[model samples]
Target: MKKLFFAFMLCTATLSYAAEGTDTTSVMLGKNKVVIHNDSLGISVSIFDSEGHQWKKTREVNFVDGQEVEQVFVFSPFIPLRKNTKRTFYPHFPDFYYGANLLNANSNVVMRDTKSSEWGFSPCQIGLSLNKQNTLGLVSSLQFGFVHNHFNTSSVIKRVEEETCMLPLEEKDVTTSFLKYYYVKLPIMVEWQKRLGRRKIFAGGGLALEYRYKEVSKYRIDKQKHTVSRDLGINALGINAEAYVGFGSVNLYAHYALTPLFKKGINAMPFGVGIGITM
Candidate 1:
């Protein structure tokens, strides 16, 4: 908005210099369309259209500074209006286009696929989808994405297995710390959207699947580490529900992870925000 206002002001200021000695002048637009004649401070323009209406904002009447006087000729406004006419318009796009955002996710929780209560990144997989957002609406796109989570955690296991705990039997003692199953994933949610606003507002949803490349779990005791990892074929996948608002190609979005990020019985809620662009 500021840029547009500044541009308008700049054009107005530069008009005087452009006017020069060219006082009495006329600008003609094709046959029987429109004509503009100008002097120093005054402008005169005429339009007699046989059919369609042609319009230009400031582009039409850029009369330079002149004392002779000028009359602004907004020919298009004078032309008769048409009911149904098809016209195409191009929308502005960002430099990196749509799918070029460097994204990263962080959290405060131990990422345990079985326990959501652990303090850590609950999302075993966080990724961005490119194919999901090809065109702003109803068009296909390629999605670039990633998923990563890891934690070196130690929890007091005395609740169920106090006998095995090194702490005093009557009081909470040594805590059992473990570096359990860590997984890094990359996946895409191929999806589409419906155009909802003049500023590119849209709402859509899609499926996101993750392929885990690494997984390992271990228990640490007295400087000694032991393996305690489990496997579930990287089932860390779910449906992505989203809502968004945008301008041109730029957009801001929020999403909810409907599927339980971890196996049942874990305490975790997955939600996130992101900045995106339309391809």
Candidate 2:
């Protein structure tokens, strides 16, 4: 209701100003200028960008024989009038972030509230613009991530025949123990972007296919370092759901694993939340 009233008042003011002989009234809508023009024939409306380029224009309305007559002389801004010379492919840039890696304890009864940390970097990202305005597009990226999981109690994952389970570590002198892994991911997403003056806002959501390429268990016992490399019953391929939103170059991003981390006998779903910067 308030918006309608404001529009009514603005239209009344524009008509009043237009009646004062070959005059125009202008208003700023964001960085664009909207101008209402009046002449001997009729009244017309036009919109211009901050750089004084005409963005859009509306038809004129003339008063003839005491009745309103509309004139049609408008061009759509979306229609391409010139040849295309812009590049079709461009770099999507990359994001670097660190966050906590959480496991769903309800699915895995043996594991307690395990504290974990993860960090990643996307060194390569390629994009293809789907529209001429570059507002919508598709992006594909390659990211590498490292995760470290710390157990509060003395525990270690041990293989029992065909199954794997976490058992108490026998080494009483063990001061610290943790499991770490590195993984590579490939993600593809559909993204949308909008420009507002000098700043731009963007949002995207997509799916990522990841593989845990390496894993290791480390322990410091009595000032001595020990390491073990094994399969650990972890799945090789993981599917994830990911999304991001941001203003300008900085963005908040999240990734949730859609599949279990372990192949059998245990259920652990991993997820990460962090901030990302373009480039």
Candidate 3:
């Protein structure tokens, strides 16, 4: 009989305590429940939040194809998501980025004969960075790229009259010449990206140094050299800028070439578009 009375008293006390704490949230300490990871190229940003998860945003870094932006805090409002905070935020980017560039040029280095040939190179890139806490942020990135171009050039040969025993043609004899060249190359760039509003429209500019060792000319005589001065531009240095519309994993980008296509203006303005990936 005494044991029963004690058990009843314990149960009544437990009920009273639950009633007192019913309307208040529990206070627990730790990191957010989501997981974060960085890619090797580092030009991207990504996040994953599962149900019943919390996080407090920690250190965030970004890379593009292995190159990273020099500066970090170019965006605004630094309210980053914490590590242990709950994963209730939507409109977040997944963990991958891949894209191609349609247009290209060598404004400061080599030049191509056709204006349309500048549209030959197709560049690819990836991005990894943290979510913007406020409206502004300090974001860094890396970028790598390459181009494959194939084109032909034809020029008219003027007529000339000559008195040489070997030549029935005149010194001003009319003739024609054509040349074709093929090249493959790669470039590396580093730049910062800024995000605004929910749509995340941002612009970034960076410098890339490229190397091209494969510019081979096909001669009229397959067995003989085409010209005494047959040299392809192997090493070229230049600059480029890009504007992108950010929507998590998808980004619409517009790119431009700041340098001329050769030692002189052999190639004209170069630009093009494709898809881009953000982590």
TM-score of each: 0.32, 0.62, 0.38
How high is the lDDT of residue 266 in model 2? 55
Q: Write the per-residue lDDT of candidate 2 for residues 2-85, one digit (tens) a residue.
A: 542354358546686554554676777666566666667655556565556664323445554456786665664312233222
- Report lDDT (Cα) of residue 130, candidate 1: 40
lDDT on C-alpha atoms for all candidate structures: 0.36, 0.69, 0.35
Candidate 2 versus the native: TM-score? 0.62
| Full candidate order by TM-score, most accurate first | 2, 3, 1
lDDT string for model 1 (1-279, tens) is 254334434444444466576543333334334444445445544444434354333223344443333345554434334321222112221122122111122233344433221111212322233433334322222233433233325332111221211112232232333322323222233323344554444444444343223434344455665544344222355545544455656756555555544443232335445565545
Worst 10 residues of 2 by lDDT: 78-87
Candidate 1 segments whose C-alpha is farther than 4 A from its true place: 1-142, 150-236, 264-269, 277-279
61 Cα displacement, candidate 3 (Å): 32
lDDT of 3 at 18: 61
Candidate order (lDDT): 2, 1, 3
Clashes of 2: 0
